[model samples]
Target chain A: MLAVGLLGLILLSVIALFHSLLASTSKSNDMTVATAMAQQRLNELVTQQPSYRATYGQDFPTDVLGQAVYAHDSQSTSTFYSQARPELLKDDGPAFGRTYYLEVQVFWNTPDANQVAANRHQQGAQSVKAGRVVYVPGS
Target chain B: MKRGFSLLELCVSLGILSFVLLGIFGVFELGQSSFHFASLRQGLQSEARVAFYALGNDLRHSSFVTVTTVPRTVSVILPRQESRGNQTLDRDGLCTAGVENWESPGAIDIHSGFPNFDSFVVYYGTSEPEGRLIRQVVRPALVGPYPNAEFSLVNSMHDNPLANSSRVGVTRTLSKRLLSFRARRDNDSRLVVVLLRLRGMGGAKPGTGARADETFELTLKTYPENTYPRV
Candidate 1:
């Protein structure tokens, strides 16, 4: 009986280690997706310029570049996030055109919604976000 | 009398030990395979990352850009921000024509009011013998043209890259193992949306049910931060 118990514990530990490895791989994949999606959104806003005012909380295309990429965890009621204020960060130059801040917050989660909710209390606290301030060519 | 276990009891214990050992070995093998798959996936991701960095650096300061979707080619015309040896030039032909208007310390830039000068760069995807590839061509300025003496080497390489692509400057290979390269652009924003997918050569990992052809994809959108409205 003692031998069985000891071997069972060892097996459980190995399984746990295996589980964590899988989690790490999944996290890495999510990170790549998040950064790329964030970059895409920033690109669209800076490039489109005029239409950016309306897409403050929009999600960029995902997967193959024009598809949705995630399911929000249940604690996060909405996948949308507000953009930071334009004047939040200052990088204006006397000669460079008036600059504005651009930000994209990517909210994604595993399909299992409740797994992380018990630990995370804040909305978007578990998400990956990327932001950049764009310089207008000339005023 | 000191007596050890009977032969039958010893055999049963050995059998149990063998089963436990087998289980342990099985777990170890699973771990080894997982590590292999993860490493291959990371390798593919890093290749995509290299392309992303190169594209971002070239696209950010572009004064003009053109994109062709079918072959996934992007052409960018950037202001000559760096000095060539001792000569600095721009649309105003500062060093060439002896002008004094540019305010930046030593560099003459388009923003200082020269709109139509500087060379362009081209990045396109192709299928080569090794694998699908993304390549770049560094074309010289069509308008003001660099000092003739300074660019003769590159000019010759560009004219005949078949014999000179490896010497650098004229052409470059960005990434390989490319499964797909797609770029979408519009006239209004002139933003280029780039979708890149690369496949790994490794076979599928056991017990994972994953396909042998491991693919990684990266998507990006970019625009010339400095391009001007058509006059």
Candidate 2:
């Protein structure tokens, strides 16, 4: 009876370890793919050279990155924003703006909210986050 | 201690031992698969970094840049090795290749117009899915006639490649398992966005990701500092 109980305990511990290992591997792989997605977005935006007046408030896809059938335990997607800060700008050209500051943020287990809250007290979190930025002329 | 008489103890012990062995073997299989993926990802990551270094170095110093669609090659016009001291670069971009009548060889070697020939570096792959990336430097022929052939040099290198094959100076292969290399010229940013995908030689093993999805991809936009500085 003692031997049986000890074996059962050991088996449970082993199962728990394997579960954690699988979760960790999935997280690592998701993080890597999310990073690559963020990089692709940044380069595409820079190459497009979006004008501030045109794309200032528009999202690239207007939707979340859809989960594939193979994706399990984690979800992934990315979004981009275009803004112009006079203080950050070397020279703020005009009212319409000649320069744009573009940012792309990738999230695995992405946040639920589409827009970031203005209230500081609001809590929104993501387990995995990666981002890239570039400055381009707003044509 | 019932002298090998109890069958219950023997059966129970054998069952536990079998369970332990099964668990160990399962872990071993999982470990093997994990190790394979980790190594594959690491190898591809390192190769991508090396390719980035080569592309970045050439793009940063480019005097002009050209990209082709079909085979997907990037050709950069780089200024020839500047003449040291009083040495003048001849039509072949070598001080010792042969002196042209226009070059005095020791008179400051300054030209009123742009020099006829500049060093060219072309980055191209062999073919799709299993291509090897190649970078070649070409210095044009001595005493060739186009006085202003900045675009013409690359034109000939692309159109009549056989005729200009002899002009190729050095060729270096970057990667062996390149799946695709794409470059898009962003005229607004004056930067080229380059994308490279590398795959492993063998087929993907039993894994979570499919073989087609196992490729490692890298993308970046780079502008020529020499060509667009303060412009």
Candidate 3:
């Protein structure tokens, strides 16, 4: 009986470790997806700089530029999304030339939310826990 | 004397230990997941700051004169102001009442005044999902006559959405999820404003709840009008 009990405890610990690994893997995947979305958008914004400058003047307005615009061509349709504000902090020191700022944000659902309720009910008295993913451009 | 416990008793104790171990492991995994999430949140804030700074640099140079006048309220330097004294005469032909309207040159009205003068209206063109696009019309004073008239169309920071050929190497935005974009001339003649939001929740249609959902504030300043002596 003692031998059997010890073996069972060992199995439980192994199972717990396996579960933690799986959760981490899932979170990593979600983060990659969000990052890809953000990077692609950032590249597009940079490319459109010249024309956007001509249309909106040298000084672009956040309220006017940050809003969504649905534009289409013969080949396909694309949405031009812009951040409400720039994505970076400015330096107090003066610099030459005009520079345009671009910022991208990526968000994903938390893995914890899906399992929180189940864990909570099963524990009954114990505190339940969970996890999520969010991505920003700079850091 | 006999063995401390029988095999049967030992087995029962082992089963209890296993149950407790499993519970503990579950809790540990939960903590790991939470940490990953926190990393992502911090990343978002950092990216927003980078974008704001890049744009601000350009706005600081919007003025024509490095030190034309002290920075003040918009009203003080308005292109048109009521005359401070008599409207009768001034050394310069400019109206004695106030500064002459820089845009009064009939033929060159659009291009005169400021160098590379462009309208400041914000526009959301049909483009991509979660995208913010703007178009401005600029008039340059250097007129060469005929085909190359002074007036020209330019894109804001983002490229032009409507392009017939890819020759320009302009890529079309894949989404339209722009939020709020506001700008104003700063005391230094630089364009200063903050963008409140951009990008929708996800695969949301334009104007839908997801599409309009943006929660970031990015302030940027660029394009200072140069100060030029009046005629």
RMSD for each of the candidates: 12.3, 12.5, 21.4
Residue B228 miss distance in model 3 (angstroms): 5.9
Error of 3 at A73 (Å): 37
Q: Candidate 3: lDDT of A11?
A: 53
Find the candidate with the highest DockQ and give its number: 1
Q: Estimate each model's TM-score.
A: 0.62, 0.57, 0.31
lDDT of 3 at B93: 6
Q: Rank the candidates by DockQ, best first.
A: 1, 2, 3
B1-231, model 3: which lDDT tens digit per residue? 776988998998788777666655554554444333333323433444343443333333333232111111111211111333222210100000011133554323344432332222222222223234332222333433222343222222333434322112223331233333443333432223333233323122211213211233333333333323310
Model 1, residue A13: C-alpha shift (Å): 1.7
Off by over 4 Å in 2: A1-104, A108-139, B5-12, B64-112, B115-118, B138-164, B167-172, B201-213, B228-231
lDDT for every model? 0.50, 0.46, 0.33
Better of 1 and 2 by DockQ: 1
- Pairs of residues at least 3 apart in sequence or in different chains that clash in candidate 2: none
Local lDDT at B1 for model 1: 100
DockQ values of all predictions: 0.22, 0.12, 0.02
Candidate 1: pairs in clash: none
CAPRI class of candidate 2: incorrect
Per-model TM-score of chain A alone? 0.58, 0.54, 0.44
Deviation in angstroms for B208 in model 3? 28
